[model samples]
Target: MEKLRYERPVINKIKAGVPDKFGMSTRINTITEIEGIPVKDIIKGYGSPVFVLSESKIRDTYHEAYRAFSTRYPKIQFSWSYKTNYLDAVCKIYHSEGSWAEVVSGFEYDKAIANDVDGGKILFNGPDKSDADLIKAIENKSFIHIDHFDELYSIIRISGNLKLKAKVAIRVNMDTGIYPQWDRFGFNYENGEAWNALNRIMLSNNLELVGLHTHIGTYILSANAYGIAASKLSELAVRVHRKFNHHIKYIDMGGGFASKNTLKGAYLPGKDTCPSFDDYAESITSAIINSEIQPDHLPTLFLETGRAMIDDAAYILGTVLANKRLTSARRSTIVDIGINCHWSLMIIGH
Candidate 1:
């Protein structure tokens, strides 16, 4: 018997008068290996459709963002957004790196408590909090950001029932020059709603307003928008201090930092276009520092960035299933994975 050999075929075609936009010469950059291990070996050991998360990458990204902020600002805290890749392993990694859990529901709060995170360190933000959830959070001393008037009254009732003062903040929704502004999370700043909430919280005996939060939008490309948001929140912080003689301990400009994932309709690759940690730090830090709030009274900066910190570290591995020809003689290949598994497909065009 003779051994068989493999060969690839090639063809040449004549050039036309016009060039195809999709026919630009592209270099195929294959991901042959990851973290000193061959991707093939990983697929062989773990099988196709396996998700491989790089522990080193996760730590590096965490350290990168932490360093970027810590070096610029004196007091900075990172709270891992539990909704973003809530796998216990992933959450533990962030916790080990000194991340406090930022949860929105009772289940995530339970998970954080189970994970040994200090209850005082949990920052609870969301619109849907049950009476029982409020009771638990109040008892645990979590920083709860209020979303609506109904929730505010509910917390007051719960505080009366439990006889415990709840540490809370009001989520402010403002137009920071970003389109499709995030107005659903908190009270509107421009319409006096945020001030109304502030006054109500200040007068309440059962609730302590400890911070101010604003989440402009997600995947925000404009760094200036963050500067604007930071200034606005600082302005409110000063106003709150002047009127109520109460100081906000923290100003949480909620996370929407762009990650390295290319968004749909992006002209340049995300790696090149996404703002760096330094850019964001400069934007927000400068605004807060220049605000009327005293330098010594500068509130702790809390960041809940999720996707920007972990997306690059997570990779979905799958094998090519088959290739088929289209009506236009174009070839398309299918993979073992689909949109459900790798949710990052939302940004990348198929």
Candidate 2:
């Protein structure tokens, strides 16, 4: 017969209403599994400190977010941002759900192509497009969001050289009553730079102005700010039609929707405080519908939100590595993984 393994005995103490800083817990609920799979089995199959992405969770979140916007707006399109979560599995999941790839760099642009996203569907954004990058975007007929005059000029030159009409948009930055405005990339709407860029694009024979884009801020907590942004973009679209008789095809409200994660030092938890998808959809859709833009030519709304869609669908599973006895006889456990979480980040062993 096999001998039984030796075990170390330990003392324990229990108290009623033992509480964490956030609140007291009547029961210490544990996450042993997700989507019907045992957590221990997953850990054993993969390894300690592994990233687990729930496919069903990802799909469910996508459907919820998509429905929130599509049900409210006449036309809506979602583009999954590579910067948000580029894990191939994650990207594929989003792509399968009718999302185009929104990339900000040459490498990421290529990555989208590699993932078999149609060239015309890819949105090329950011301020750092190289001549080569612009050439590829022009060749692919991708939506190139011009960030500044230099990039605009580059696109014009590249498209002229290629004899191709590059689908394009101008990224407009503005004071949307949000502090520390994102005025770094794109033209300033208040200063008439955005108009100047639009005029320049309309004059260019090789560039087709398809849309107006804006990324107000990241982890934005206010749904009202999105309404303000939509109003501003709609006004620009109406002006485009008035001046050049050109109705822009779309308005890209680059994503900044907050995930359910509390900011450091925040008093309230994120789950209770973050704006809902409905809140944002109501704000943005109402603004465009109420704007001066003609109802017959209302532009398609492009949303690049990804964080809120994925935060709840993925998690890091880890195990405790060692235990040390303190001078006061208290035990301390340690783990390999490092993280930043809402409450204190402590590792646990299975």
Candidate 3:
């Protein structure tokens, strides 16, 4: 004989979240694992508050991005932006994936060299290059992206003193119809500053114009803006070839490609709105390929995307320290990690 057990009735409360236009809550599914490893196991092994980087994911992402551009353009070169992550392991992973180094500081340049990156393959870019940095870059024959006239002339002077033809390029800043234009870093395209800088580089005996570079803006959702930038840089390349009979080695579309992070006020989900690798490839490649530049003399396309490449590969794993109700009656969880630091240098960049 079986005895029937008395059961207690349980009540459940369902909380309604704010819904979007279609009346669907945009709640994201929680992550339970990364790369087939359970979060519990990972925390158990490495402890919470540790940063985990999936090497497999990094290689996969690099290959995916490389494929997106390579399938569209014949000459495409990818450089790892050292400021993003720049952990020796991460940098080595990218370098092993055939990405050259794109450094914005003497320290990064040195780190790249220490990583056994060929000095000639490194790209030195930024507004601040010390005299010592210039000498090292010149000695190494790295691609020096000139930020201003001061740097251009300084490189010319240094190169002349060293009796070496420094491989140089001017960073062209253009109005790509994007808000908060990044006009402060390089020469302006609309106001003839870019052209003037090109002419100055062409006129220098100690400097060889190797490329034309432009970094429009960051987190740009518009693919057409990249098309505009590509077209302008291509036009500049054509003009340089037509005027000086010197073909530039590459067109560096300095990376500002947005990662899939929704802004504070974004109505649409980032996955739905942000441009994909294919979208950017189509825009930039199509514009350059269809430009007035001769087909035979088309320059190499260089992409140095950072955040988009490494964002998904690594994560800061932190355990919740406390659950508290604020005076405003809002619920919040305090985590172990503070934003004040990292490998320290990972957060230190331009």
Among the numbered candidates, top TM-score falls to 1
For each candidate in turn, the TM-score is 0.91, 0.88, 0.90
Sort all candidates by TM-score, best to worst: 1, 3, 2
**lDDT for predicted candidate 1 compared with the true structure:** 0.87
Kindly list the per-residue Cα lDDT of model 3 for residues 106-194, writing each as its tens digit.
99999999999998999999999999999999999899999999998899899999999999998999888897788899899999999
What is the C-alpha lDDT profile of model 1 across 1-350, one tens digit per residue?
54765635535365452324544223235797877777777778777777888888898899999998888889999999999877787888899999999998989989999999999999999999988889999999999999999999999999988999999998999999998888878999999999999999999999999999988888899999999999999999999999988889999988899998766555556788899988999899999999999888899999999889988987777888887778987666788887577432111111
Global Cα RMSD, each model: 4.9, 5.4, 5.4
Q: For candidate 3, list the clashing residue pairs, or say none.
A: none
| lDDT for predicted candidate 3 compared with the true structure | 0.86
Candidate 2 ranges with C-alpha deviation above 4 Å: 1-30, 325-332, 339-350
lDDT against the true structure, per candidate, is 0.87, 0.87, 0.86
Q: Which ten residues in a row have the lowest lDDT in candidate 2?
A: 341-350
- Stretches > 4 Å off in candidate 1: 1-7, 10-28, 342-350
lDDT of 2 by residue, 162-275 (tens): 899999999999988889998998999999999999999999998899999999988899999999999999999999999999999999999999998666655566788899
Better of 1 and 3 by TM-score: 1
Ranking by lDDT: 2, 1, 3
- Stretches off by above 4 angstroms in model 3 are 1-29, 341-350
